[model samples]
Target: MERGRDTILLEGLRILDLTYGPSGGYAGRLFAESGAHVTKVVTGDQEISTFKDSRKRMIRTTDNQLPETIAEQLAVGHWDIVLWDSHMALHLESQLASLLEKISGSCLSVRIHFPSTVDVKEEHALQEWGGWTSLTGDPHRSPLYIGGFPATSLVGAHTAAATMFAWLEQKKGFVQVDALTVVVSALEGVYTNYLETGEVRERVGNRHHTLTPMSIFPCQNGFSFIGAPVDEQWELLERWMGRAPNPNWASVDERQQSYPALEHCIADWTQGMEREELFHTGQAFRLPFGDVQTLEDVKRCPHLNMRHFWKGQHPSDGIQLPWIIYRHSSCKLENRSHSLKRLRILDLTSMWSGPYCTRLFADHGAEVIKVEAPHRPDGIRGNSGESPAPFFNELNRNKCGITLDLRQEEERAKFLKLVATSDILIDNFSPRVMENFGLTREVLWAQQPGLIIMSLSAFGQTGPYRDYVGYGPTLESMSGLASLTGYRDGIPWLPGFSISDIGAGIHGTFALLAALYFQRRFGNGLAVDLSQYEAAIQLIGDYIIEETFSPTPLQPVGCTSIAELAIQDQRPLEVKTSDGKRSISTPWIIDNPENQTYEPAPTLGQHNPLLEDYMAKREWHHQL
Candidate 1:
């Protein structure tokens, strides 16, 4: 049977969704959206978001009936995936073992856990415990909650991806996805910075920790984010502002030193123009500038509308729904211990998004080769002279690293040769960077026609803002996340970390898994164009839906009061890197029979000799 682009990737997969809360609901929703037959067993009157229940078939039942419902469903052996939360697991504790036994070999069970002390209903407490509230908002004021139930949504993404990974490996035992771990994992450089420098990361309002000129500024009508981290962007900004570049503000460190003064000058210049005008003019200079948009403004965004990013309104409330747009040419029922052992991935991504995506695969036995340029490696590495930052080491662990200056013809040839032997190629460069390097999708396909190519761009390819540069903050502002995440009286605020980057990375991981499945099943190649902008908007889908039907606009509440409670476990799980540095372990916990081990991130070009040996052998194989 031939599958068209419109065909759902997980079409025939059956999922038994016994989850309550946003986390499990969202996970089940992802499965449902991918065309799985997801039967959600709603046990209580607990409110459910329309976004989470979009494509699922609901089965209303009472707490008493829940056990029987799940038991019956598992007994039939019809479900490929089973999703539930810790609360429900406790509810059916006596029968939980038996119910799980029924699907032990046939189905994959995923449990989303939170601390026993914290109630799932208390969003603020979860945020605080998860280390999110501590890092958001202004340093002096109360820490703010990231708008929408982002922590739960992040857990949902993890749950869905874990289930898919288990399914791909054909391992059907038990998987536990901790909500707090998911939140902590997305903290990016926070923990590492504290570990390395003993300096706890505090709120800096809309400013980034490392990047200068990457903060929000007030315009004539409203505020806009300006992210120009590179020296080239700084030069362009100066030219646009009609000022000669000063030698003092040349490098990143110098600009950081002069942030206050530079910010003042930029603010003065921006104050003369309206928000829209400033956005367009800044974008004209190829700067990553975006107007802080409200939910209403996001609804009317031309790029989102053109892409049909929003599904139809809610059935009962007429509220708009956000949709995940997959470009196509794209899970599972299997359990091999090392499912991806033979697979090789070429990771040409830097910073968080791309590295984070490939890291997931690297942890699960996939051979991932992280490719960076000799001159300019991943930005997260900080200065070339210093050791790779803790965050970089944490994200790039278990992967081999090699340097390739693609600008040089020799390096480009080496990269192409690598692509020929690799199964997947991942990059998060701007849409033009790849094309300019003469490594377009067409060119890559010629090297390995069955290659699964995924390009994670700021705004997607072919969109009006495709060429526009953006970081996490830029996307957050442009996608309406910043607008929804601050105090009512305060201006828009960015999240504690580059959340959009992390979210897009998880989405990319899931998409790549699906693409790999499709390739193995049908022998076809796929090109995935993932837009961080759209992924950011999807994170606030619940808010978008709620505001659509509400009489008044949604307003941000600074922070909710948290109660002191005893958590089940007070100790944080830390793993030792190859360099003896302790970092957080992988987020989720799996209870499979196979044991997995961790490895530290490789040093720059650490595996160049090994890669060269492999490439020589691959070339020899090709000649034969």
Candidate 2:
């Protein structure tokens, strides 16, 4: 696994990409970017877009030559990974079965499938079938689909991740990733709420289900999200509005009851101010605010520009991608039967982005320590009196939870002790929080120089908006996603859930794995600054590129109609939690014999004793 300094993370890996659409194409692009030698075999006259095809070698073939071409390629050399779409499977099922048998023990093959309900390869119709369309846009209007092929893009990401997992584990198998399951998995709290309470959530325009003032408000020039979901943030908003904190608007429930009046009051205050002014002012008050940015605005975004996020040959094409800033160093890693069995992660993340990122690793046998302060546990755990939320259990499954008030010196010392033996540290706090905690890269590296630190923030760790706070909706609004979502003539609307959070999590997991691969091969430590905003923009990068090149702007269609078909009602695979509550299983379906069984999420501080033992040993020897 040794490589030269000039080699990229996945340089030695060879991938044969036989994907027909953007779903598999995006996955190949990610592999290519990480330095894998990706060869895309095009069986038709499909136009190759620079965004998805730039780093890959292209081979053309007719439909009739597909099987022969694949056999020829497979014979020439061993490919570490092979990717194809389900549509291609219809024609080459027997051919693939024979070919795969020859390479079954050596290569990881991934097939991307649309739901059976989708008779055509239409993304909009797939969205409708997956329930994404039904949950987006205004409740009074027709359901809207998210801009770009987000569902498919997510499928690609998940497919890439699954492939990497198998590769790391040195397993030979076939993996199936479907668009419908990926979409349903990302619905986040929506399905969980329905299952737990039997409450079918409908479109609430731009507002959050429980969080008040988390909606887009019109500014003098454009719209901006004034999200103050937390009580502290809401109080700041009240002070900024030159009003005393009224008792009626004290709690989330109270604010929900007074939604109309509160929204009207905020809208009135914001209507006269420009979006930029409102954004900065609200951020200065420590409120989570964001500008509803268009593609043009996103192109000129100072934070993205400063981070050099818009890369590739044509930087002006507005092709935004993830940027991983690395520092040179070295460490030794032991190979394990399970991909991440030897890996230890300290997850200091709350809500969705960071938790979801670590959860992926946890599911694959990583020792993930979900660290939270006693006073401020992960917000998704729900209020003090209630049981942990279903979304929390789903996202944090198979992870060890321990409360450590980092603010206290004793707890901070224990955490640093754990860091000395850990491989990675991930946090989604505002950029300043790490600095405030005096846990800078230099400080953490002093304990373990080869530690891979990943920070998933709203606007990243640098740039002007580095300190600004934001949630998934804020990032979505700012990432140009919201502007392209909604009816053609209607205002921009957010997706049913915090899609940006989930998207960032998936992207973060991939990026972290890439870094992990590098660490294992070269023993080098890296710092990955993942912005949920940039990650959101990347999901719709093709659309942005299209809009940049096209004469007319891309308009949102509420929902596209398709011929009626017998949509399959295949229930998603589920596993029972420790409480006997059923939850959707992890989206990947890999035919690997060594896959671990599902485990229930840990209760708060459930693994405190485990942490105590690790601290006593000053090493991670005992498995949870």
* Most lDDT-accurate candidate: 2
Name model 1 segments beyond 4 Å from true: 1-7, 89-91, 244-250, 312-338, 548-568, 591-594, 619-624
Q: Candidate 2 on 281-358: residue-level lDDT in tens?
A: 888888889899988798778887777776643454546457556664454544422357778899999888888889
In model 1, residue pairs whose N, Cα or C atoms come closer than 3 Å (at least 3 residues apart or on different chains), thus clashing, are: 169-335, 169-336, 170-334, 170-335, 171-334, 171-335
Candidate 1 per-residue C-alpha lDDT over 1-624 given as tens digits, one digit per residue, 9 for 90 to 100: 122223366778888887777788878877777677898888677676777786888888887787787777677747888887877655585476667876688778888877665565645556777677767877777677777666777778888888888788888888887776677777876765556566666667668877899888888888999888889988988988899988999999999988889899999998888999878888888888888998878877888756556554422332222223333232121221225767789999998988999998988878898998888888888665248778888898888888899999988998899898777898888889999999987788778777778888888775688787788888989988888777776588888788888888887887777666555555666777778887787677777776653221232233321111112254334566656786666677764313656677777888778767766775422110
Each model's backbone clash number:
6, 0
Best by TM-score: 2
Candidate 2 Cα misplacement greater than 4 A, ranges: 1-7, 119-122, 312-314, 317-320, 330-339, 548-568, 591-595, 619-624
lDDT of 2: 0.77
Task: List the candidates' TM-scores in order.
Answer: 0.90, 0.92
